[model samples]
Target: MIPVQEREQTDDRRSAWAVFLVFLRLGLTSFGGPVAHLGYFREAFVTRRRWLSERAYSDIVALCQFLPGPASSQVGMVIGLSRAGYRGALAAWLGFTMPSAIVLVVLAMGLSGAGNQVPAGLLHGLKVAAVAVVAQAVWGMARSLCPDAPRLTLMALAATAVMLAPSPWCQVAVMVAAGLAGARWFRPAQAQAHEPLPIPVGHGAAIGFLLAFFVLLVGLPIAHRLFPGQWLAMADAFYRAGALVFGGGHVVLPLLQAAVVPTGWVDNDIFLAGYGAAQAVPGPLFTFAAFLGGAMRAEPSGWVGGMLCLVAIFAPSFLLVFGALPFWERLRRNAGAQAALAGVNAAVVGLLVAALYQPVWTSAIHAPADVALALLALVALAAWRVPPWLVVLACALAGWGLAPS
Candidate 1:
């Protein structure tokens, strides 16, 4: 770790307040999606600030990617934790999450009744932009994480399974099994050994909370079957969706689409529309839940329903990550347990690979234009050094001009 005085002397000497403000700015300025958000994070924290060494940052990325949650959001939490513990985590999360959630709320409320007030061309363009951003992420992730043939094979297998089944239960089970198998059998190309668990603090509490919440969700539907059809029914759908989610955010998209859109809780076009907009905003794509909830024209429109969706999707993840983290250390010290986690972490990578293909890549790539756009977005990102927001905006305009919804 960089020493404290030296840390203070670093060029980007942001105070706690300054850090929050910086993230807040990052949140607002973040318009493309998570891949772009990664770019932004690298620019602000690594290149500009040098707040963390490359090794420490990579370790955090490894840990975040190994765990089940939104990749960008988890990284934000780790950065916050590293910078200022719990408070930093909260600030980063809030700063990252709130902007997107708030924007979606507005769209959910106003657009529900307004119909296609957003130009069809605009929506189409945004969809194409969304595809570009997701593809960029997949390429970046594959480059960094899945280096060897075993990991690549695992990723391919996982993606195929999800594209076929698209079930949460199926996804999580695969992740667990893969991790176990990797620990027992697979080796990194260099023959380096893997750490069993690299989760941060509060992991146990997070798991306990998930258990308690799961019980409430399952039991409440069974017990209050007589209650308003709306409340209990909503609980069941969201709860089931949460239970089965594996890779978080994008992984949950198919499940959410199945639950809310097809069931008539939300219109299909509206769902895709919300998804397009979700890409243009910061924070987890799972917050698209807000669009589903608010557009249902629920009693508590705008923020209330949007907040409900936000909580339903993410609360479980926070519990799982922090709760699972603390005991993971103990598990690491045990050779067998470490062995198991070693397998688990490798499996987690497989699951991530599967997710990137099934939902993240497939859903977004709808056309040849989309493929070209995605490639161009990556080129601009990796080669030309153009800012992401600009790429997103330009692609959105291009999509509108070339392909109208």
Candidate 2:
């Protein structure tokens, strides 16, 4: 088995910096959505840079997909953190999310119905870009993880389930359950595999960080309900939303709408409009929470308040993923565990597939031109070896002209 780089060696400033820049570029240039983000990721990380082995990358992706909270985005964070530590992860995450946050905030101030408008053609092109991006991800993941009929079927089922329920959290839960079941029942015979990456030092600290976050996530909300106005309430709302979020960004809408509308934060119009705009932008959708928070401007108002809301929403995920990552090596190879993961992974694939179709595809593919544009984008990626970033841009233009939202 090839020796994966030691943590100490991989955790260099240069590595982290590279990841930061890459994600930053992605946040600014990549279009469509999370599914598209994944495609751009593959084109850059898996295919272009060769940062991770195919299996290693796919495993991480599969795990993220099965769990929730912007699977692709989380996967990127995990990868960055794994290579560089807390700061590395932070840089990568911030770079990826900051652009969207900035855009959302700026746009938030302009939603007075008299906001400057763009040509419908441009919005439609963006949709085309989204379609192309998902197709790229589906192709890459299929080749890597779902190489066989059974695996493909598993992924298909996951997508179908999502189409039926359209509930992100449920989708994640289904995948997790399936993965755990697969690990238990279908453990592959032990063989030589990549040597486990060294656990980042002080596994205890990682666990503690995770435990503390979760405790607050569940505990603070109840405390807030009982004793409102304190930081606990703020923490509770954000953490609960973070904990429950499956697909991230747009998925956060339905859950958030229920939470805030009842509390008299913002009406449905603001919530849905922000969500749609979030889709139109290039960065993390969680930043929509930032926009919503800014709009709320209740107690912890202004940029600081928005930051708090955003931090609270994303904190649990950051903690949980890091805490679990140190142990992923141990878990991934365990037979009983592998059996469960197999099932879950398949379901995750399916869920992702469904997501690709609905929010990703349905939103964009409205015309025969869209179909053509998507096909051409695929050809560029699968055939001509073009960067996904370019494909997304081209498709966005095509969508703007052809479909003209």
Candidate 3:
């Protein structure tokens, strides 16, 4: 008979593998961005698998939302970590992230090779679709996050500030200012008691992860300046974008635009087109990084660049989730922290609003027909409740049809 220890080890491996398989399915099929991804996760893990109690699941979601990164992706990582330790976390991330990342990278490469052959109408349609998607996000987030007058006012101010300044540092500063304003003025409603999370990480390990997160955040830029390699610079830019953005995948847009577009690393058209295509795929929207990486004008611009960017952007999420899980209980319970987070969330909505106007709106909406298409896309997304991927496909066809013969 197998020894008891050996049997237990085998079981652990099986558990990790199971986690990966489940999330791989999710990666392939889950759509509609972060909020929808959360619903898919809830159905798969809580209702179907009964992996954890509803409260426990919610608590995990809250913790991830409270921290920076893609909330849905972080939620998946936490669920996996709870089930089978660190190995399980890695498996979950790989399974959920890879499908979308791979798709975007391949798409980017194809667009690059297609060059002048790619239909202008199709590309334009994708940009129009992006405008609608960002508008929907802004609308939805406004309703949920800016319900109160104070928060609404804060959101408008943040939007105005971002639009006026329009830089990565400006965006980060706005979030910080909003958080401070929230801590001072906003009083968060008392939180409901939550079930304790089942994360297996200890405080020491958590601290180590947290330290690593900061070290990389600070060290990457300095290293890039000193070494000045293309790969290092790309890693630094992607890492900073991943680490700083408070909201989910959509909020990363302006930061990413600033990072790649100005440096002549990626053209504005390619960047926006990739973003538009990202909406059509499953899993996290952050996989747009893969597209940008693959489409870069310089060396390491194919699969190698794509993988580097995918890893760099997502690295912080892993570190933050692992680091924060242990201390999340106390942090969540802190009223001040909750209030500040509320403000930060409000700011996130505003930041998205600015992005909608500048890059998404200005780039896509050139004529009356484009406006009409955007309006229709928004209606389809927000009112008809049509699935996003379907809407994206329809828009692509419409754009192609409208192209000058």
Q: RMSD of each candidate?
A: 5.5, 6.8, 3.6
Q: TM-score of each candidate?
A: 0.72, 0.64, 0.96
Worst 10 residues of 2 by lDDT: 191-200
Model 3 over residues 54-75: C-alpha lDDT tens digits? 9899999999889888999999
Error of 3 at 399 (Å): 1.5
Task: Kindly report which residue stretches of model 1 are placed more than 4 angstroms away from their true locations once superposed.
Answer: 1-22, 30-62, 78-89, 187-248, 297-301, 332-386, 403-405
Compute the lDDT of residue 30 as modeled in candidate 3: 95
lDDT on C-alpha atoms for all candidate structures: 0.64, 0.65, 0.92
What's model 2's lDDT at 298? 60
Model 3 has an lDDT value of 0.92
Q: In candidate 3, which residue pairs get closer than 3 Å at backbone N, Cα or C atoms, i.e. clash?
A: none
Please name the candidate that would achieve the greatest lDDT relative to the true structure.
3
Tens digit of lDDT per residue, candidate 2, span 1-405? 434554523543446787798889988987656767778888876676666667777767755754547676787787677667777678878888888887766655554233337455654665565556556656665676666777777777666766777654665566676665566556567633443443353689878977887688668857878887835655666667777655445545545655665677654445444554565667666777777766563666446656777888888778777777766666665666556655755664565576567666666666677688878977887789776556655765665556423
- Residue 215, candidate 1: Cα error in Å is 3.5
Q: What is the TM-score (0 to 1) of candidate 1?
A: 0.72
Tell me the spans in candidate 3 whose CA falls farther than 4 Å from its real position: 1-14
